[model samples]
Each structure stands twice: as structure tokens, then as C-alpha cells.
Target chain A: MAKKQLPYVIGCDGGGTGCRVVLADAQGQVLARASGGPANATSDFALTITSLSAALAEAAAQTGLSPQALRASVAHFGLAGVVSPAVAAQVAAALPFDHITVTSDREVAVTGALGGADGVLLAIGTGTIVAAQRAGQRRDAGGWGLQLSDQASGGWLGRALLEQVLLCHDGLHPHSDLTRATLADFGAPLDMVLFAAQAQPADYARFAPQVIAAAQAGDAVGRGLMQRGAAYLDLALKAVGFMPDEVLCLTGGIGPHYAAYLAAPAQAAITAARGSGLDGALWLALATARGLRGGAA
Target chain B: MAKKQLPYVIGCDGGGTGCRVVLADAQGQVLARASGGPANATSDFALTITSLSAALAEAAAQTGLSPQALRASVAHFGLAGVVSPAVAAQVAAALPFDHITVTSDREVAVTGALGGADGVLLAIGTGTIVAAQRAGQRRDAGGWGLQLSDQASGGWLGRALLEQVLLCHDGLHPHSDLTRATLADFGAPLDMVLFAAQAQPADYARFAPQVIAAAQAGDAVGRGLMQRGAAYLDLALKAVGFMPDEVLCLTGGIGPHYAAYLAAPAQAAITAARGSGLDGALWLALATARGLRGGAA
Candidate 1:
């Protein structure tokens, strides 16, 4: 005889770039997926809520379940900029989930990357997310925003590139191909000075691709930056209790690019992520639903 | 025979710290001097104007001349944050000088350091000013601001120190006494993250003395930072056409501290500044008056 269907669950992964939502069953069976606009709670809470709601509604429609009906079951949201319990509480109040869990995007990313197992996560993009998970507990270092931390990130690479260009302009350092081209792109050092004054982290991250490509092609400055970034990553992984034999998932727009620069041990430990942050949210949602039903979570 | 006394001239040196005004004869003889509150135009334009006006009035009073009488004389202002022609124009329009020359503080600092002779100036403080003065013209490389440039400055040293502490916390590098003490000061790395988020260049500069002292004591991190800073200074000095035999005036609260870290040739070139920024302003004002009199300028 066929088994009875389980209650529907919802999971949402929100960030500055965009949002992803998943529809699934309490047993962790995926039903449908949906994408939405940017959902960074810290950047635009109202817009983030709208994006999440629309995406949840879309995923629910794909599974032929009303969002309200899914909300009655269980839901989990892993969102960027949810740095504190107060922020998570605010997000929970905004969403229409009856039984919902809200957490930082890093936690979900690590969960998805490691498939809920113990390992390390290096999510380096415009910002750096260095975290480790052990027995379902998560710990992180760095990612303290660009002004203080976020070292070895795309933003860090781009900012360092600009600084090098100015140094070359001053005749303190000779202009490598990377520095020369970068300075040329901005017209002059003064123009770069103007850009740096107002450029945000994302704005600086725009140069990461160039730096990555240059590093691959043996540009001294580019390779130097990648090496520096790799060194920081090595330190961060060790700080997070990353054993060389354990899975080390290097994920993000810029993370994979550093694979070539990683130490031999980290290179050996590198592994592809099992799933995405949305998947991790769905796993969490499934666990929440099972717990509420008095079943093994 | 004793030369006839020339008309009075005025010179003002205004910075974030405070403003100084000197009243002197066109022949460069000092008449009187006065001081006023902070006059950083970018920080508070109205207050800068007030500071300048009050200092000018006070100096005129000491010389037994009406403020209005001094306004008829030649005056030169070397001011911080006078980056553009528009800013200088605004300053000129606000002050009551019949003939006024407005320029960047860096220019006057170089003049004061070099005493109107061609040489290099290394002015490192919360900011870094690297300039080469030649035949009445000045060319500068850094001093773009703390955001992009200002390498080897007290601000840069302090910021790097904080970055090192974070790196150590992440297990990326070993901590020295400097980093350990620095981390202890904040109680925890998170506290430092909090402090750095709102720290200005000056705020970071507060840690420079500790780093300086630690380097003196042979603390590994402190020495590393000083060495790195000295490397940048070497490049800047070379870029500015600094020669082993040429005069190199290292001036500023943090400038002389770097003497021990400088290269052998740079150490050999070091010379005490002939005067101060205030004296440079006076020299420029006298020059302006002499030009007006159709005499040697």
C-alpha cells in the first residue's frame, strides 16, 4: 500500500543579491522551487519581506498549496543581515509563518554546504563568511563588515588593487600589468581617489573578476593578492577547527577561484557543496515540522 | 644703512587641530602671532571661518593695527581640506583680505620643511603627505585621504595592527605581544569589531603609539608593521625623487618616529625642518607682498 503524503513545508534563503524559496514535505522531499528579488533585511526590510513573500507564494503555487496552508505546517528563513536575535525576531514577526525559525544566512549556507555534517565553510564574495559547523553547532570568524574585517574577500582584493595602483602612481612601486591597467581604467590616480571616497564594498568587488583572471595568467600583483587571500583563508579554517581531512567547501562567487592558491592540505580537503542555502533551510523546516508532530526530528 | 620697513603682511596656517596666524613685515620680520580653535574647513566651514577671523583679529590687535588695516595687506592661508579651486574661492570670499592666496596645507608644510629650497617632504601622521618641491612647484603622490591612500601613516599603522589582531584570533598568524595586548584592550575580538565599525582615521591612529613602542621592544607584529610601513615609505620617497644626498625633511607628529625604520640612504638625507607650516605661510605672505611692491620675490 502507498504511504500517506506529509504536510507541506517552506524554506527561504534571503540575501543582498536575491532570494530563493523551496517547497517540500515534512520528510524532506523537495516539491518545487522559486526565485525572487533581493532580500537583505538590513538593507531594505520592507522590500525583503515583499520578495520573500512573493517567492514563498510562487513556490506554494507550484506545489498546488496555498502559502497560508504551508505557513500552518512549518517554515524556516535563513537571511543575510540577521546578525542578532532581535533582527531574527523582527523578521519572524514580519513573515506569516505559524511555526518558523529565523537565522543568519551563514548558518544556512554552512548547513547546506556540509549537508548538516561537521565541516568548514569558506563563503567569500563581496564579503567573506568564514565558518565551521560541529555537531549541528556553528561558529564564525571575520565577516565583521568591510571597515574592520572581511579580509580575503572580493572587496579586499579590489581595494588592495586600487591601493597598489596609487603606490605605482607615486613611483613607490613599479607598475605591474595589473596596476597599469587598473590605473588606466580609472584614467588617473586622482580619478581613483574620487572613486575610492564613495565606493562601497560591492563597488570594489567589481574588480575581483579581473584580479582572479590576472592571477590565473600569472600577474604578479594579482597572484600576490590571491596568495594573501589564501593565507587568510588558511588561518580562518584552522581557527574554525577545520581538520585537513575534513570536508572544506569553498563556495561563493569568489571562493572557488582561490582553489588554485590554497595550501596543499586545504586543496586536498576541498569538496563541492552538497546543496545550496535554500536546501539547508528546507532541511531545517522539515526538522521543525517533524519536531512539532512529535516525530524524530 | 638700515633698510626702510615695508608694509605689514599676514599668514594663517589652519588645520584640524587648530589655527595659527602670524603678522610680519613684508621683509619677513615677525610683528605678532596668535592662535585659535580648530579650523578644518571640511569638518565645519563656519567654525573654520570663525577661527580664521578670530585669529586674524587677535594678531592684528597685538600689532596695534585694526583688523580692517590688516585686511588691506597681503595674506596667505595654508589650510587643510582646500583640495579644489572652488573651496579656495569660498574661503577667499569669506575672508576680508584684499589680496589672498589659498592653497593646500601640504604645500605650505613642504615649504616650511624645505625652507623654499627643492627637496622631499615626508609628513606622516593620521594622514601621509609625500611630496617633492622644486623651483616653487610641488608635486605630491599620496595624501588622497584615509580611505584609499595614506600608506605608512599612524592611521595605517593602527588599522593594520587591528587587522593583525583579527588575523591572529582567526589562527591565521601567530600573535605577538602587540597583538595580544591590543586584543586584551578590547576584551574580545568582537569588541574590536564593534570599535572598528565606527572608527575614523584619527581613532585608529590612537593605537599607533602602542605599536611604535612595541616595535621598539622587538615585538614581532609591531616590527612587521613598522617594516611594512617603512617599505611603503621607501617607495614613496623614491617616487618623489628623493636622493641620498638631497635634504629630506620628515615632519609631523608621527613622521620622526619612522626615522629608525627608514633606509640607510633616507636616514642619511634626514634634516630638521627649517621652520613650521606657520613660518611657511609667513614666508609666502612676504613673497606675495614683495611681488606686489615690484621688488625681489
Candidate 2:
């Protein structure tokens, strides 16, 4: 039997904190977007499916589509904690969509940031990673996940700021605005026990905004933490063989905040991402639907 | 009901990692010493009691004391993660003892470091805190636990080393012996995720020895981390009103390693702790048994 081209597609960005689903027509025009609860496939596969289903329902509702129609749409999932191929297959099998592709959030992050073009996308939110596309060949330098590395990410910055606060806790270095503010935020040194005792990557990342704010306020320690994080990002770009003059997109929550601290040459190379990870996922799904795998726009 | 001196006393130092019990006489003479499993009271009060009991039994076995005899002995516990009086009371009440007193691990840390004399102790192991004894008045500056603050501790140093390794992951900073050693230990960045994802304070602290060893070998990054930690220790000491020529004992696992990094004046003031936390517990137990509270030797 011959198949008719699906009229729409769905792009999913599933993370530990929450999930985002985007619905678009075959022409890559957005139809609807929605959000749902967490979908960390590694820790809870059932929850991932449930979250995806909920998010899909919301998107379909927004687009005035029926459940069966939406189910027929091609879908692409860029999820956190989806590191292994086996897990990806399991997720794909569990998903209700007729045609679907699942990959690391990093992949869609790069695709979305670069809009299927050959360039680099450095995602530095709760976690960190650098992904680049050149002549349709893509490679990643970091983002092994939060356990191993996420160098210049928000979580990394929060962790680094915490270390700085503890380092200054001794007054071995002069107390700076950063330390004072951090201590004030977390309260007494003793109060920090509960925070660190139960802190996840997102918990640590929660302090990134504060660190950024402090840096902007001329806090020496804050600036140091910011610059250090940026340096790591810079290193990640270089590690992936990022050449000057090539387009580079700094993606994620804290990615853009680091621009000012990057080297002049690299800074000059930086540019806005052509689209969001949703756009990238949609493009991936559309391309895959046509049997054009890893074919960049 | 005239007061009678107890025949024996038990001094306990219980932390997240392990429990130490020392059995002593009313005269503060050490009789038996033993170790047992972890006993973080805040995490699991029942487990704490079990571990403490196990440690106490070992100490009793060493002295050939029966269970009933040991239960008759007054027990003074210095336990980690017992931040509130309520928790302490709960722990004390759960113990199978005729009489019991519960205080923080920091208290015995100071007592052990100062040997009951008026002085200050900076404990930097898996956590950080400073306790000062002056004019029979005891004051503390830190040791809030790993969450709140533990500046210059093994955990802090380990965390710093991890940051350095991540930073040097980009080779932004030159590869030093410290980074080399850390990478070799963790294998690759990918392996670090499992470590960070599952790491407790002790897990991060495990790298402290490697960092120290690297520093001794003249690794620039290692020395930087060590020196930074020492500075915090100095700050902690100063924060607690450390006076020149006053006996300041540096305690804990990484306590001694930071000595060289301390400033000249502070280093000059640093002295060897007269006893261990067990000894301090014994001293405190004896003092309390005699109705002398917080009184220096």
C-alpha cells in the first residue's frame, strides 16, 4: 500500500524539569505549542510516555486536530537523559505516534540553533555541551551530561559560585559582593547544608541567574565565576574545531549571558540561532519523513 | 538520692561516614575504642542508633564490659547532621543508655582539638567549621555541614579539583599535574557523569588526597586549590576571633595538609591538637558528669 505524506509533525523537547511539544504542518509552519511535566526517560520511562502524551494532546487541541490525526503526524523527540540507543528504541516503541525519531536533546539543540545549517550550537543551561555541523557531518565536544561535564552551563556556574562562596567563607580572600550576596541568598553557612545535601543539577542551576545578576552589578567574584564558565564554553567550541568566521549560536538559559566574557575573535563569530530546538526537531522529522537522514537544510 | 559518680562513660563521634566510640572511666581514663558504620542522625535516626550501638558494643567488647554495664555508663554523643535540638533529643532518647547527652560533631571536634583548654579548632574534613573556646565561653564560626559550608575541607578541595579538571578540559588553563592526575583517575569526561550523579560529599572528597599529592609535586592547579582551601580555613579561624599566640588546633582529615598554606602569623599560632574528638567527648562527658559545663581545662 502506498502512503500519503502526513499533513503535520510534532517536535518534543523532554527534560527532567518539564516537556515542550511543538506541532507544525508539512511546510514547517508552526500550528501549536504546549508544555507538560517532566520526561526523564532513564529514571521513569512510563512518565516520559505519559508526559509526551499529555503534551501532544495539548498541542493537538490547540491546533483543533483529532487525537487520531495527531497520532498520524510524524514526531521527533529531543530529550534529556536519553543517552543510549537502546533507551531511544524503547522510547520510540512506547511513543503513540506512527512515525517518530528520538535523539539526545543536544542533537536537536544544535539542529534548532543552526536551523539545519552548518555551524555550532553551544547549549549551556542546566547542563553544557557543544555541537557543530560541517558539510552535513556533525560532532559534539562536551555535554557528556551533568555527572561528567557541563562546563559553562548554568548548573556549572552555580556549582562554581558555590565553591567560590566556600573559598571566601574563610576570608582567605577578601569578601566580595558575590560572596556576601550568595551567603545572604543561602543564609548562613550552616543553612547551605540542606541545599547541597539535596541539590540536583537544576537546584544548582537555580543560582545561575543570581550569579549573572551579581556579575552585572560589578561583583568581582561574580565576574570571575562568569568568566571562568565562559572560558570553559570557549574551550568547548575550540575542542569541536570551531573555526573563526563560521556562525556560532550560544543556546540555552545562560548561554547568551556568557557572550560578553568570550574572547574577541570568538565573540565576533557569534550570531543568533536561525531557530529554536523545536524548529530543528520539526526539520529533522520532515527530513526523516522523506528518507533524507542527517541531511542538513 | 545523693549524686554518685558513674563507673564509666562513653564518648562518641558519629558522622555521615562512620562512628567512633570511646569508653572511658569517670576519671576520663580511656578504656576502649572502636569504630562502626555511618551514623548521620538527620538522615536516619534509627540507623544512627544502630550504628552507635554497634560502635559502643565494640568498645565494650574491648574492655570486656557486658551490655548491661555499657548501658549503665553515661553516653555523650557528638554526631553529624543533628542540626536541631529536637533531632539531638530524639537521638539521645533512642539510645539504650541510663543517661545521655547529645551535641554536634563540631563541639567534640573543638574539645578534642583543644584538649579541654581555652582555644580554637578549625575542623576541615568532609565538612568545615571553626569552634573557639575562650574564657569558658564556646563560640562556633562554621562547620554548618557539607550543604551550608565546609571551607578548606576535603570535600571542598575535591569539588574544587573537579572544577579545575572541567576547566582544563578545554585546556584554557595549562595541563598541570593536578588535572592530569584527576583525568587519569576519572578516565574520561563521560565517566564523570556517574560520579557526579551519584556522588556524595565523600565521593568528591576522595580526590583530596590526589590533589594534595599533586600539589606536593608542584602542580600549579593543585596548589591553587589547596591554597584557596587554606585561605578559607584561615578566614574561619579569624572569624572565630583567633588571637595571636593562642593555641589554634587544625583538626579533621585534611586539617594537617593545609598548615603550610596558612599565613605566617596564623601558622605560628597553630598547634597540634592534644587529643582526638573521642578524647574531647570523654573530657566533655567527664566535665558534665561533674556538673561543669563548657568549662575549659
Candidate 3:
């Protein structure tokens, strides 16, 4: 005897910071949304599994569905650090769902920004990644990772701000509120050096918001950091082949804020995402389920 | 009585990288010169003892004397990261020498650069620091640490080179031998990200020589990094109250190479170091010896 399969679909957008999930019915009607801890399968498989499970349970709980019933449903995942196909397959296979699909977080971001249409996206946060899609052909630039690229991201911006504080302390640059705050926070340059000696990109990213706040308050150093970040973002967009006619979307934690500082033309072309990344994941999950049911998406 | 105190003087210049020692006769004539591994007394007391022991043994061996003979001599210890008086006393007590005088590595560098006279020094290396001695009043600028200052240091220049490499990879800057080498060394930006996630300042400083070499070969990126480093050095010098006709001695592992890039007047004022930091430590040791003997120096 065949047990009844639930008509549930789940979409996940995961990264080093955390994960977001959306649950929907077979008809693509959104039913619930939830959040979870970070999920980077490549870095820690067990942690990613635990986080995804909690997120899934939360989503399932919203709809009064048991975990067993949800396991029979279809699922789609968009995650960071899924750079290799092997890892992608491994992550997909690790999931509890009967049917599964997995792709890069950038794909979900682009899909979310353009609402399944053709366009480009400049997403900024703890990191930056540029993605473009034209007529079903997609290309990505930047997001080479925080060290070699993602120059305009929150992590990069924070590092630059700290450097500015150091430069100011050295008298290579003038002091500002931003630099003062940084010095106060670190107590001294040695403290900052100690912090940098061990700080990860996520740790550095914590300072980005303070830099932005100081910039908005008219601190010269802070404004300079933002301007520099904007310029890098522009360069990244051009490098990724952003076109004039295509609708461009700036998405992510710091994306909308950064858009305000972009060049006038780029500013004019900027548009908000049509749907969230979780929404895009939900759409993909629905499309996958339709394929399984032998129906048009 | 007093072990007929050996008529000897030992001068030590110790830092995080390596240690230099000089053994001299009662007349202050050098009898030997030797080097040893890094000796940071406060952090690793045992390792410091071992390194200083080997260095002293080598110095004594050059004079055909035993280590026990050298132990009765007056010793001057100028070391890096020896910031507190308590630590200084502890290090002095730990050494085998009967009379011990401990100072900072910077003190030796300044005294060495100035030859015990009144002048200013611009020292550049893995880090940058400027010291000025005028009428017995000394002032220091820069070298707050790599995080807060050290604007034009080898570490700073290396970081600039890496950023330039990333910029080139993003097409925001042009390609050059420097960028190509960087990419080849790291395998890609992703690899670089992983490296940065764990790299220390010394790790970054390792690339500075390569950058300088490429610059000497007329690579634009290389030239730019040197020029920027020089400008920062200039700022550091000015901040420390460098004066005209002050016999501005540029000293350190990479100092002289940077002098060629300084402004004309500043370059003209530059002079060769009268002696090495080891010589300064020796001079101080001689003073200590005279004081112990109840004689005027």
C-alpha cells in the first residue's frame, strides 16, 4: 500500500551567516516562513543539517504538518559555498525530502531580484557577489570570495574603515569620528592588530554598520569608505556585463543602502527585488514539484 | 672574589624575527658577531634563554672563551616587545650575565641610526616606525602596530600589492607581473580568501620583496605600491618632527630602498646609518660596564 505524499514544497536560501526558508502548497501559495542558524554544508555538514532541520520543522509546524509528512514533500535549496557540483550533489542527497534540487545562492538571488525574468543583481552584505542573466544565459562576476574579491561588501568596507582608523592614527590621513570610534573600540592599534590577527570576514563585517552610520552622520572617513565601496560595486557590475536596458536590482543586507551612492546612471537603473530570495526558492520548488506531477510550471 | 669579573661586554639586539649579538673587549673593540633565532623574553622564557645562550656561546667561541667566561660580562639587551619595566627586570634576572641592562629594540634602532647623536631616523621594515632625537628629547611616530599604523612597512606594502591583485582580477585595475604572481601563488581569489582567513602580518610581509623586485623592473602596480609606501613614510617622518639638516638616516631592512622614492629635499637630507642597532647595544653595554666599574664613560 502506498502512503499518501504531502503536497508541500520548501525553499531555502542559506549562507555562512544564517538561512531563510519558505514553505508553500503545491499551487505555489505561500503558507509559512521561518529562519535558522547558518548552513554552509561544505564547511560543516552536521551543522548545516541541524540548521536546515530546525528551519524545516518550524515551517512544518506553522502548517500543523508532521516531520514525516514533510519528508515526503519536494524541496529546493540555494546555498553559499556550493561552488562545486560534487558538493552540490552531496548536499542535495543529504536532505530529507523525497525530491530535491540545489543551486548556488547567487542563482536564487538573481531569480529573486528579477522574479524569474532576465536582469542583473548587485547583492551586498558581509560579502558581495554580482550575477547577471540574459535570455537564459547566466554569468557571474566577483564573489570570488572575501579575500580576492567582494571589494564593496560589508566585510571589505569594515576592513577599509579599520585601515582608515590606523592611517589616521599614523597621520597619513586626517582623523574623523569614524576613526575615533574605531580607536575607542579597539583601545589602541595593538588591540586592533590583535583583533585582525584572528578576525574572520564575519567578525570584520560587524563593523560595517558603524561605518555606514558615521558616514551618514557626515564623517569624512566614513563617507570615503562608502564612496570607495560604491565605486568598487560599479566596477564589479561592469565587469559582470551589466547592460543598460536590463532592469538592475540591488539586493541583500546592505544593497539598498549602497545603491544610494552608485553613479547617477546606475542609480537610475536600480530597482528593488520583485520577490525575496526565499520566494525564488519557493518558485523553484514549485516548478520542481510540477515537473514531478507531469504538469506545466 | 667577584670571579675576577671578565673584561668583556656583550650587546644583544633581539626581536621577533632574529637576534644579533656582539662581543667586545674592555676597549670597546668588537671581538665577534653572531646571530640566533628569534628571542622574545616575555612570551617564551625557555626559548629566549636557549636562543640567547646559543648567541652568547657563538660570540664567546669567536673570542676562544668559554660560555662561563662570558657570563661575568656586562650585557646590554635591547629587545622587541619588551615594553614593561617588570618584564625588563625579569629578563635581566633570567640572563646569566652579572650586570644586565635591558632596553627596547626601538631604543637601539634609534641610537644606532643616530650614532648616539641628536638626529631623526625613519625605519622601514615588516612595519614602519619613525624616531627623532633632538637635544636628548626623543619622540616616536608610527609603528603603532600593523593594524593602527605601520603605513609604509613591508607588511603594508604587501597588503597593498594583494589588494591591487584583487583589483586587477576584478578588472578595476590593469594586469601586471605582480598580479599574475599573486594569482599564481594563491591559485585564485578563493584560495587567497582562505589564506587571509588565517594569515598574519609576517605572512603578508613575505610578498613585499617580490613587489619591490617587480617595481624595480618597471611594473606599474609595483611602482605604485612603492610610491604609496614612500608617501606614508614621509607622513610618518613629518609627524615625528623631522627637521631640515637633521641627518635623517633611513634605516631598517627596507629603509634605504624606499629613500630613493622620497621627496628630493627629504632624500637629500638622508644619511647612512653610522652603526647597526647591535653597535648601539654595544655602546650602551660599554656605558653600563663603565658605570659598574665606577668610571666615567
Candidate 4:
């Protein structure tokens, strides 16, 4: 009797800070998982490709599969900086798979959360971006960047906290416990604020947890920033035509926390995605594999 | 021969908004300014007051002199809100003065411009408010209001025109020539925007010019709301101490325009005799009476 072919797929999710890869079978069981360094394809394509490759190799090693064997398998990538067609092609070229597909990290997250339904997905982690999928079309709202936009992201919160500290140092605002703690973390003279803000968005986002803690401890400045941040997200939701009963998915680290602050309309619209970028990638991989079978036949 | 006491001193300058008044002498000055709807206080307060107030008493009419004569007369007032405690009080209480003295309207202008000399000022009109002056003290930088805070000012050009319109439209942010023209005129959907944003600080500010123009165009939405209308002035300049520049001054509108914006700031900051409220009021009236000072005391 002929041996039966195993049904498995490979998936990758890449971001500015890191890349994650997962190997899974048809039963939705993860066989192997691996992580690596930054993989934002737009800003640093070579480094992103290298990290993605290493992560895939690490996952394959766990499965005891050679590079050649993995190359013949189906795979999908959910990657940052893949908004442009040229960038998407570059990401696709980096991955080794018989059938591979690439899409924006935002698109993958939306697909994973809503099962490819029509709704808005507010992905706010280290950075913030709002993407709306309606009637098979997509539109982007905020997420200009750390400097000009991204009004409700972790980075924005950090920047606002730093601004409050600087304002206090300049005697332009009242000094508060949160400002004191923030100044202590960064050291005296307070001129370092300009330097701190010069870092990339993800670097700034890492400081958001401290701000959240400060807010919870009754820091009016911190609390105000959070409220403003949530309000910014609400504005984005309004831009996307968020219906009261629509299944709006909240993704990323800060999304869950910010979800609590959303109004009844937004709350009723809220639903957490069952799968993340990895799951979406895996789904794409399986779909690609099915397409390959039909094409070959 | 004994010198006759000039009991009344009147100072007036009118421009694109309304007329202003200052009644003072060498010893001290009192102020009374009235809004004539849309008369320019920077150019002709004399004519504007005719329409604003029921009747003008000639004794202190043109020179801000009181109907009753007093000794030693000096009247000066910069057209717009200049920094001065006396000026602020006069504007606030509508008090007529003898021996009235006013300084650069810019001084009281800062109170209204920065919302009360404790935050950044971004006054945008024909000019801007990028000035970084601290209250009652000299700093390394003071950009002269319109010349400096232009970054945040409506007169800053570039993105500001677009931002005003976009912010007005529920943050939908559509860019078009029609939108730009509508923003310049402060009409239509813009009227709705101004009404809806009456409570928000940024929104109130964004819609102020719209309200001003609507009143100019004889629209009902703009005419009847004076106190709330003035509150927009208070809100925009409210964050004076939010940064190192804790004092602001105005560069737009006419003399009485500054009065509306400065009323709250003067009440909050002027608790003593030697405050900017009085000083600015005296300075504005004096500046207007520069040529007519006769002889120094």
C-alpha cells in the first residue's frame, strides 16, 4: 500500500522588534515554534529576511526536517513593511516553500480574528495602526508613524509621559509622582527627552508598561494620556464606521487594556481574534497547498 | 496759572474684530472695551463702539477720557490683547478710567494667547504665535508670538489649513480645494463642527474662526454666543504652563479680541496690584495715545 502524505504547514509573523515562526499540522496543533530578531521588511529588508530564514530553520530543526524538505512544503508570511507590492515580492523571495504567500501583518491579523469577515481591526502594540475590511475591500485610518500619527499606541503613551516629565522639569507644569519617577529613570537635567524620543517606535513602546503602572497609581498626567490614547482609538473606530453590534477585533498587547475604556458601542463591537498572525499565516499556507493540488491536477 | 485736571482719557484702536477702550491719566488708567460685532479694533474703535454701545459720551470718547475731568492724562493701548493687569481688569469689568495707561497689546495678548501665560501659544491669523516668553521674566527665547509659535499656529501655513478642516469633519480628514475654501470661510458643515465642539478644548479653538466669520456673514450660529465664544479663547491658550513657555500673547483680531481671550487669564493670575492684567491694560491705551501724550509727567 502507498504511504499517506502528511498534512502540515509553516507560518511566519514578522515585526520590527522580532519574528516568530510556527509549524503546524492539519489538526491545528503546533508542532514547533521559533523566534528571532527584528524582521521589518521595509526598513531593513536584508536583516528581516535573515532573521526570518533563521527562525524557519530553527522551527524545521525541531521537526527534524532538512532545508530542502521544508522548501517543498507550503508556507505563508504575515510581515510588517509589506504594504507595497515590491516589498511583498521581496518577502516572498526570502521564504523557502513550494507554495508561499505574503501579506501585511495587519491583513493577517484581521483574517485570523474575523475568519475573513468584514469589520475593523485596531492593531495597537508597540505601534498603532487601524485597518478596516468592508465588503472585500480595505482602508487604512491612522498609523502615520511615531512622529506625526499613531495617536493611540504604546509609543504615543511613552512620548506623552516623557513630555509631561519635561514640562515638569521646565516648571511649566506641576511636578507629580509619575513625573518624578520618569525623571529618575532617565536621569537629571531633563534634556535627554529629545534623545529618548529619537529612538524607533518599538523602542519607545517598551516604556509604555511603566506609564500604565503610573496611571493606575493615580498619576493624573499618565491617566490623562491613557484617556487621550483611548479617545484617539475611538476616533479611528468612528472613521471606520464601527457599528454597535459589529464584530470588531482588538489585537496586540495594548488592545486588551484599551478595550476596557471603549464605550458601549465599541464594547459591543469588540471580539478578540481566536488566532493571531501565526494562525492566519498557517491558514494561508493550507489554502495555498489546496490551490497547488488543484492546479497540478 | 493753575493747570486744569483732565479727568477723562480715552484710547481706541479698531481692526477686523471690534473696538477697545482705555480711560486713564498719569497716575493710573481704567478700561472699557466693547465688541461691535466685526469692526476692526486695531484700526478704528471710535466708529465700532458707536454700533456696539448705545451711545458714546464725548468727554472720554475718542481719548478714553472720562466724562469727569481729572489731573494728568496718559492713555495707551495696543490694539489686540497685550500683557497688562490693568488692561485685563478694565476689559473684564468694562471700567472707564482717568490717567489711563496701556502697553503693547501683545502683553495682554499673551494672556489670551497662552490661555494664561503657562503654556505654548500658537496664535494664527495674518501672523502666528510661536513666542516662548515666560511670565514677568526674560528667557533665552521669545519668538514674538506669531513669528515663533507658528509651528502650532493656524497661520503656520502648510498642514494647518488642512488640519483645521479635517479636524472639523469628525476627523474624516478629506483633502480638497472646496474643503480649504470652506475652512477659510467657516461655513456649513463647519458650522455644525463648531457647535458640536463647543465643549472640547481643541475643537472649541478649531471652530473659533468659523464662529467669528459666521457672525461676520450674518449667520445665526455665530451671533448670539459671546461668553461661550470667549471660552474658546480661554481654552486654546489654557496650556501656557504645560511647557517651558508659561505665558502667551495674541497676534490676531483687534484690541477687544484680546480682551475676550484675556478675561479668564486676568481673573486667575491677577491677585496683586502689580500684575500683567493692569499693566497690559495701561500699556494698550498708552500705545494708542502715543502721539497725543502732550508732555511727559
Top TM-score prediction, candidate number: 2
Q: DockQ score for model 3, please?
A: 0.36
On TM-score, the stronger of 1 and 2 is 2
Estimate the TM-score for candidate 2.
0.86
For each candidate, what TM-score against the reference? 0.85, 0.86, 0.82, 0.56
Going through the candidates in order, what is chain B's TM-score?
Answer: 0.84, 0.90, 0.88, 0.37
Full-model lDDT for every candidate = 0.82, 0.78, 0.78, 0.56
Candidate 4 chain A: minimum summed lDDT over ten consecutive residues — where? Answer: A189-198
lDDT of model 2, residue A181: 77
Which residue pairs clash in candidate 3? Answer: none
Can you write out model 4's per-residue Cα lDDT over A1-297, one digit (the tens) per residue? 665465468878777678898888755578899999877676568998889988987898899976776777777888876756777887787666666788877767777766668878888876676877878787666554443356778877776776666556544467788878878876763234334523565676777888778777878887787889888788778877777767788887777767766777887778768778777777778777777666755
Candidate 3 Cα outliers beyond 4 Å, as residue runs: A1-10, A15-17, A22-104, A281-297, B2-4, B7-104, B185-187, B281-297
The model with the greatest DockQ is 1
lDDT of 2 by residue, B186-257 (tens): 797546655766666677888889889988988889899888887766776777788887987887788888
Clashing pairs in 1: A172-B235, A235-B172
How far out, in Å, is residue B189 in model 3?
3.8
Task: Give the per-residue lDDT digits (tens) of candidate 4, residues B34-113.
Answer: 33332223223344335324323433355554344423444443344332354344442342344444433444444434
Instruction: Say which docking band candidate 4 falls in.
Output: incorrect
> How well does candidate 4 match the true structure, expressed as C-alpha RMSD?
15.2
- Point out the higher-scoring one by TM-score: 2 or 3: 2
Better of 1 and 4 by TM-score: 1
**Residue A201's lDDT in candidate 2:** 68
Best candidate, lDDT: 1
Ranking by TM-score: 2, 1, 3, 4
- Between the candidate structures 2 and 4, which one is better when assessed by DockQ? 2
